[model samples]
Target: MNRRTLIIVTAVVAVGLFAIGGLLYSPTSKEVAVTKPVSNEAPLVRPHSPVFGAKDAPVTIVEFFDPACEACRAFHPVVKKILSEFQGKVRVVLRYTAFHPPSEEAIRILEAARLQGKFEVVLERLLETQPRWAPHGRPADSAWSLLDGTGLDVERARRDAKLPGIVAVLNQDTADVKNVGVTGTPTFFVNGKPLLDFGAQQLLDLVEAEVASN
Candidate 1:
């Protein structure tokens, strides 16, 4: 081949290789921003949302949860398992999506428990006893009696549940649930990517992928 022709071919090959490299490159978590999917707003993590695990963890699992949801109750342990598996690398931010009529009261109980630093404990108890209180197509019989040994001050929590601050939190979470387009309980987003497949294994795999990317 002529010298000029060889040089031209080499330049073309190099350009092609560079373009292929760019196409093959996958963005890491640090390179991407986790925002609301439709509106392209800021990160979905709200300052007032109840978070589980390291507050500064690199991976975030945002769960739009309804306290009266049986699926949320079922998936509670699955989420805990993911936290246990990831340790300090992942955290869960729970937003109240109260689809059921009784869920607001249940959330009030939880938020009040949060104020008293008993969020996790109270949550476990509520879920553990959920079936008794929350039957499908009906209001929860009432969760107050179920808090018997969960270390929450029932009387004080009842009063605190009525607080304007607590009510505001509930209001904001309800608004966010609508704004974010969460139609059901236990809808999960891993680093802003929705879990469309919707299963325990799928959730675990998504978390694993995000953690590895980070």
Candidate 2:
């Protein structure tokens, strides 16, 4: 080969190796810091608090979820299991991504439930019964049915769902997802670092590692 060709080949090889090394070593970098801006919107009412974990918890897991997404449905149990295992050790923040119209309604219902101080009960019911109600089309009927079981008056729940303030909270969550560059359902963030694996064990491992280091 000519001297120029050899030089070009060497540079290309070096660049390729650097790219591979960066990918392999990237995870060891320090956690990214996320600064959430203060919003004038009213606080959401819900169980376990909207904050990802105990304010004192060492690790935080932020999850962006879509109510009608099948993958989200599948992820709920995994999240529940993790929470049960790590209870107060890790903080988990759940944000609605609203990728579908039904998700908007679902977010509204959740916000309304928060107003009633029954948000956790309502959220669990929705996640648990998603398979029976969430199908090919809009799940408005199913959503209504689930709310009915919450023992909070159905008319009151509907009214709360339509409130402008509740809708604003949903919008705020949607904005959060966009801000974080989350493009899909059930994306998890450990200490503000996005976990692409989506597997329960992988996610737990990341959280555990973060906690151990602290």
Candidate 3:
């Protein structure tokens, strides 16, 4: 071959060898993709917390409520409305912050009802008759009567309510209440984000926004 042609041929061969080497040493296209870390949000539900909705729902709303608080009663229907609207998209986790005089007893009562698999019914009945049971000052003794037909087995509940497990649940919730800076009943959180401003409309809007984003 002529000198110039030989040099050109050598250069082409060298380039081809380099290209093949690069392909062999470099990572495959599928293996070279950047990977992002998985997000792990703080847990919103506790073992003792009461849950409403699908167990593995995308959105969680944690509510610190006082059973004796009239505002809690008022907001109960609103929360139900929001849940109904969202259906399976959201779940509510109820935590106790028993500020009222009878609120602790109410919590104990609910805990007892939970043991009997009657948590929902007793909760509904308690809220429905909160005024009568958890009135101003000392709770009226008449409150016990309201639980008669609630499938609560009031006597059993009364005994179980004082047990260590229920007491521990109440104590832990109280501590969390302080840690979370819950000043009053019906305080709400959506997806570990606190409700900065308190209002029914504000809660609904926040929930709606979370639902849309998720």
lDDT of 1: 0.75
The estimated TM-scores of all candidates read 0.79, 0.71, 0.77
When summed lDDT is taken over every stretch of 10 residues in candidate 3, the lowest stretch is 23-32
Predictions in order: lDDT: 0.75, 0.63, 0.72
Off by over 4 Å in 1: 1-43, 137-140
User: How many clashing residue pairs appear in each of the predictions shown?
Assistant: 0, 5, 0
For residues 1-214, could you state the per-residue lDDT of candidate 2 as single tens digits?
7543443344344334444542111111112233342232122213333663476677777777787766666555556556666778887777777886567877777878777878788888887776656664644356877666676666788898888887777767766666566666667777756675545556778878887887
lDDT of 3 at 40: 35
Ranking 2 against 3 by lDDT, winner: 3
- Compare candidates 1 and 3 on TM-score and give the better one: 1
Ranking by lDDT: 1, 3, 2
Best-matching candidate per TM-score: 1
RMSD to the hidden true structure, all candidates: 16.6, 12.7, 25.7
Candidate 3 lDDT by residue in tens digits, 1-214: 7543443344344334444542111111011111221133323457778999877888888888888876677567667767877899999999998888888888888889999999999999998898788767654766567886776788888899889999899888888776565666677788877776555556778888899999
Q: CA shift at 158, candidate 1, in angstroms?
A: 0.8
Native-to-model Cα distance after best TM-score fit, residue 15 in candidate 3, in Å: 79
Say which candidate scores most in lDDT.
1
